[model samples]
Target: MKFTLAKPRIFFKVSRFLFPFIIVMGVLCFGTGLYTALVTSPPDYQQGDAMRIMYIHVPASWMALCVYSLLAILSLFILVWRHPLAEILAISAAPIGALFTLLSLVTGSLWGKPMWGTYWVWDARLTSVLVLLFLYVGYWALYKAYAHPAQGIRAASLLALIGAINLPIIKGSVNWWNTLHQPASITKLSTPSIHPSMLFPLGLMTAAYGFYFLLLLILRARTEFNKRKCLVQENFS
Candidate 1:
C-alpha cells in the first residue's frame, strides 16, 4: 500500500528533474543528425542519394519496437504489482509508439520504391511490422473503449503482454525468411555493416529520437497524474 501510493510522488519528482535536460539534448541531437544526414553523409554506392532516406526510417523503426517492448514491461508491472504509475506510463506511451510505427512504415515504403521498384511487398519483416502497428492501434482503441478507467487499463495491458510475442519475430523475420528487406546493417552479432560516415548521423538521429520519446513519456505521465489528482480532489470534496 505504501509502495503503490508512493509511486506518483517519486515519478513526478524525477520528471521535474529530467524534463529540461532531455528537451535540450533532444533538440541538439536532432539538429546535428539532420545536418549530417543530409549533407555530410556520403551517397550509397548502389542506391546513391536515395539511401539517405534511411536516416529517418531506421531510427523510427528502432524506436517503434523499443517502445512496444517498454509497454510489455509496464504491463508486467501493472499486472504483477498493480502499480498506478505503471498504468499511467503504459497509457501515456501508446500513442507515441503508434506514431513511430506509422512513421517507420511510411518511410520504409519511400525507401522501398527506388530500391525494390515497388512501394511494398508481402515480405515477412514488413508484414510483421504492420502487425506491430496494429497492436499499438488496438491497445489505444481498447483502452479508450471502457468508461471505467481501471477496467480499460487492465484490458489494454493484457493486449500489450500478448502482442509482445511479435517483437522477436519482427526482428528476425528478414533472416528467417527470404525477403526483399535488407538484413540488419547497423545492428548485428558484431560490428555494424554500415560505414562510419553513415553510422555517425544515424547514431545522432537515434539518440534524438530516444530522448524525444523520453521527453514525451515524462510530460504525458505527469499530465495524466495531475488530471487524476484533480479528479480525486473533486471526489473527496
Candidate 2:
C-alpha cells in the first residue's frame, strides 16, 4: 500500500473558510462567558470575588496542557509519516500553547495570593506546570536554531515528544502527591463538585478557549502553508 500527501489546494480552501468562522464563534462565546462570569455569577462562599479569576485561569490551564498534548501527537506524525501539515501544526501551536501556559501561571499567581497567602508554591502541580512552560520555550528555541527546515522540525519534534512526559505528571500531580492544588471538580464519576452558578460560566469559558485555540491553530497553519507554497513557486520561477 502507498500513501501520498493530499493536495494543498483542498486544505487551503477548507481552512480559509473554517478559520474565520471559528474565530467569530470563539469571540462570541468568550464574550458571553466573560459577562456571565463577571456580572451574573454569584461570589464564592469561601473566596468571594477572588474566585472569579477561575473563569480565566482554569481555561488557560486546560488549553496549556491540551495544546501541548496536541503538539506532541502532531510531532509524532511529523517524525513518523513526514506529514507537512503535522509539522506546520506543531510549529503553529507552540507559541499559542506558550501564551496559554503563561496565562495560567499569571492567573494562578493572582488567585493564589489571596487564597493561599503566597504568589507561588513548590507544589507538584505548580512545579510541573512551570516545567511545561520551559518546554514550550525550549521547543521554540530548537525550531529557530536549525538552518534547514527539516533539521529544525526534527529537533523540535523530539523536544515535543520528551516534554509530553510532563503532561501526565501535570494531570495527576494532585493525586500522585499531596499538593496544594485542588483535584478535579468536574471529571469525577460522581456529580460535579462545584455549584451550578460557577460551573456554568467555567464550562462556557472552557468551550470558548477551545474554540479560540482551534481558530488560532487553523489560521497559523494556513498562513504557513501559503508562505511555503509561495516560496516554492519563487524558487521554481
Candidate 3:
C-alpha cells in the first residue's frame, strides 16, 4: 500500500528538485546560443545573411521532430505499463510539440525562399514535416475529443504509435530522393560537414530548445495532475 501510494509522489519530488536546475540551464543555453548565433557566428559565404536563418530553423526543426518522438515513447509507456505519469507527460507534450512544429515550418519557409526560390514546396522533406505537424494536431484533437478522459488518452496513444512511422521518413527524405533540402550534415557517421564556427551556436541552441521542452513538460504534467485530482474530488464528492 505504501509503495503504491508513494510511486506517483516520488516522480513529482524529483521534478520539484530538478525544476530550478532546468530553468537555469535553459536560460543559460538560450542566452548563450542566441548571442553566439546572432552576434558572433560568421555568415555562411554561400548564403550570407540568409544563412543565419539556419540558427533558428535547424534547432526548431530538430526539436519539432524530437518532441514527437518523445511523445510517442511516453505514449508507449502509457499503453504498455498503464503509467499515469506517462499519460500526463504525453498530454503536456502535445501542444508544445505542435508549437515547435509550427516554428519549424515557418522558419523553414523563411529560410527556403532564398535557397529554393519559393516559400513552400511538395518536396519530400517539406511534405513529411507538414505531415508531422498534422500528426501533432491530430493527436491533440483526438486526446481532447472524448467525454471520458481516460478513453481519450488511450485513443491518443494509439495515434501516437501509428504516427511515429513518419519520423524516419522525415529524417531520411533528403537521402532517399532528390530534394532541395540539404542532406544530413551534422548528423553524419563521419565528421560533421558543418564548420565549427557555425556548429557551436547550433549545438547551444539545440540544447536550449531541448531543456526548454523538459522544463515545460515538467510544469504541465504537475498542473495536469492537480487538475485531475480536483476533477476526481468533484466527481466523487
Q: Which has the greatest TM-score?
A: 1
Give per-candidate clash totals: 0, 0, 0
For residues 41-159, write the lDDT of model 1, one tens digit per residue. 99999999999889999999999999999999999889888888899999999999999999999999988888899999999999999999999999988988999788898899999
The residue-by-residue lDDT of candidate 2 on 193-234, one tens digit each, is: 899999999989999999988888887888888788898999
Better of 1 and 2 by TM-score: 1
Candidate 3 local lDDT, residue 75: 90
TM-score of each: 0.96, 0.94, 0.95
Off by over 4 Å in 1: 1-6
Q: Candidate 3 on 116-144: residue-level lDDT in tens?
A: 89999899999999999999999989988
lDDT of each: 0.93, 0.90, 0.90
Model 2 accuracy (lDDT, Cα): 0.90
Query: Model 3 Cα displacement at 176 (Å)?
Result: 0.6
Candidate number of the best lDDT: 1
Q: Which ten residues in a row have the lowest lDDT in candidate 3?
A: 1-10
**Between which residue pairs do clashes occur in model 3?**
none
Q: Estimate the overall C-alpha local distance difference test score of candidate 3.
A: 0.90
Which is the winner by TM-score between candidate 1 and candidate 3? 1
